[model samples]
Target: MTMSLPQQAPSPQHCLIGPLPQLFHGELAAYGAALAVADTSAPVGTALEAFLDGPQLAAALALFALRFPGAHPKALASTWSKLYFNALLVPVLAASSACGWCFPLAPGRVRFLADTDGAPLRFVLEDAGAAHPALDSAARLQPLVRNHLTLVVDALATQYRLAPRLLWNNAAVIAEETLLQCQLLMGAQPRIAADLHFLCATAQWPDQLANPLHQPTRLVANVRQRQLCCLRYRLRLDFCADCPLDCRQRQAAQRKLA
Candidate 1:
């Protein structure tokens, strides 16, 4: 069984916490994400590379299958990526813009925490110490995409027989949404706002490869729409309100009800 984590504890000395406690309070806390300190109370958990390897990925897929009965492998993969990005990106990007800190997300330094069912819960990672110096959007984002997310996306795509674009879309949507929220909250700080804007608006990283995150959504008519469907409806969930595949009429109706 997954033991309940101890009541909220003080962040470890080297964990990323610059302005996080204040930024994540009150109603905004619902959107907050953080890295858990590595401690005995939490299980040692699987290393990030283990997900790319055979055993841990298989176990995680089995648990996801059990968790979302009738989900196709595609939907299952999407679900996993959504959770993964939420746990990692929301906090990391927020800290980067809000406090000028960047996390060292190398696979070796990061671990994934899961419940008894092997469902991912959070990550345990250490801060990389000082922040990078005035990096452009491409340089600032390169390590995050290439060093960390790309490996995970490649693994999931190969394992699930899903397209890499779909997985990238999953991450892109989360990143786009996170940056938008950060802008709303940190708009008063020009650098923070600019960082958020450059991260969102730039199409390619330093490598000049087509950025999957580059405008993953668009303003369709008046309503915004996702560039690609996440395929979750295959699992029997409703099409995301912004899904491009869903007709504009249905989207309008849903918005009215909201």
Candidate 2:
């Protein structure tokens, strides 16, 4: 959704990337203690506010930026959440499916970050190579993947009391953003070896989503329409790359003289 995102200089001396497990090779306990204070019982806004009391939020934001380096956050809570969810669900699910597990995600259980400014700067699922509880059977993989992804998104939406369509819209955006990236990755020479290619794999779609919510909640639903406008154009002079044009929907009073 960010156009012309400002490039933050990567601190080669500080950034790190690797199998999340190896990255936190021996530090899970300390990491858990740091996030223990987040107020999960409060209202959405209150919870997010309390959860951010320490450096946890900043660290999480840093993790969110790992996929697309130098990505900056917007003031909108939705924006922050969308980025965070993309970081958590997209890559994590793809990574899990790449292997044979259904690694559950949470603010705590899944790998979070202390910092990402060091050597080896791409965060990946080192655990993906291993198998876990799920059957990974063709009939079950879609629900497995969908439920895992929906679990995190649902919890976040409920925790933050976000709007009804927030998670759905976010899911839409993630699908589009991911497929676009994969298309580029597909064109790489010698074939880039990556686990994140599932986003664009047709074999991954038909069963990716568990329910047929929305007009069509298939893995990459409505790819034909591309993207629904972020609706920002309704209030300002800006439109996102996939924002659907609806100039006709504008009030006659606000019509321009073009």
Candidate 3:
């Protein structure tokens, strides 16, 4: 079962991708407060941080469980990154583009709220999804998603201020990895991957992008204890099917058998 938008009815304000800090500030704030663990703390940072932890990552996984209902918990846990790509990242990109806004998401500017079960319910944007197109609305949408990815990563690294090379390496790696999920959710469009490569190229990412459709090279292996991603690690869940650990194991096992 694919994770298509729900068909109950589309309320402009009641969208999976709703205008935040405006349309549903109450709901956003309530959920954000849980992350901040206090109202006065920074909600945005706390919310993004949730994507990394097990309890918080559940918010991402729940989206898949809802769509592909009846899947075992372990099964859901295996592809947690897909949940982040489809539910958290893509919706923000799509919703913002539909309204013709940048909605430049930094951790502090957005809040992802979840149900009591940790399923992502909606995104609360820092600005209205109002459109003021600088270019043709149709042509500009893809760039919005690409640009948002670049901007948010910088912001996350800055917020953490951890000089470890791992953060940068992982972000570059995951950018390509997550784009695949985005393409799957978009029904396997080739352009999504193309635009993603364009963005990585335009940003001059340290990892030289060889092919937009292939794995991007990380300039340095800062992956100390790297699992290619930490999404499932929090749950002690199985490695993602394409995770580096699993990849190496498969290669080694193949060579040994030969």
Q: Rate the local accuracy (lDDT) of all candidates.
A: 0.67, 0.37, 0.41
Please tell me which predicted candidate would have the highest lDDT against the true structure: 1
**Best prediction by TM-score:** 1
Of 2 and 3, the candidate ranking higher by TM-score: 2
Backbone Cα, N, C clashes tallied per candidate = 0, 11, 1
The alpha-carbon lDDT assigned to residue 26 of candidate 2 equals 38
* lDDT (Cα, tens digit) per residue for candidate 1, span 33-53: 346545555545667787567
Model 3 reaches what TM-score against the true structure? 0.41
Estimate the lDDT of model 1.
0.67
The better-scoring model by TM-score among 1 and 3 is 1
Order the candidates by TM-score, highest first — what do you get?
1, 2, 3
TM-score of each: 0.81, 0.45, 0.41
Candidate 3, which segments miss by more than 4 Å at Cα?
1-13, 16-86, 94-101, 104-109, 112-114, 117-121, 131-194, 201-234, 246-258
> Mind giving the per-residue lDDT tens digits that candidate 2 earns over 113-200?
3234311112222233334535433332345345544654564455446553555565655644543453463354221122223332
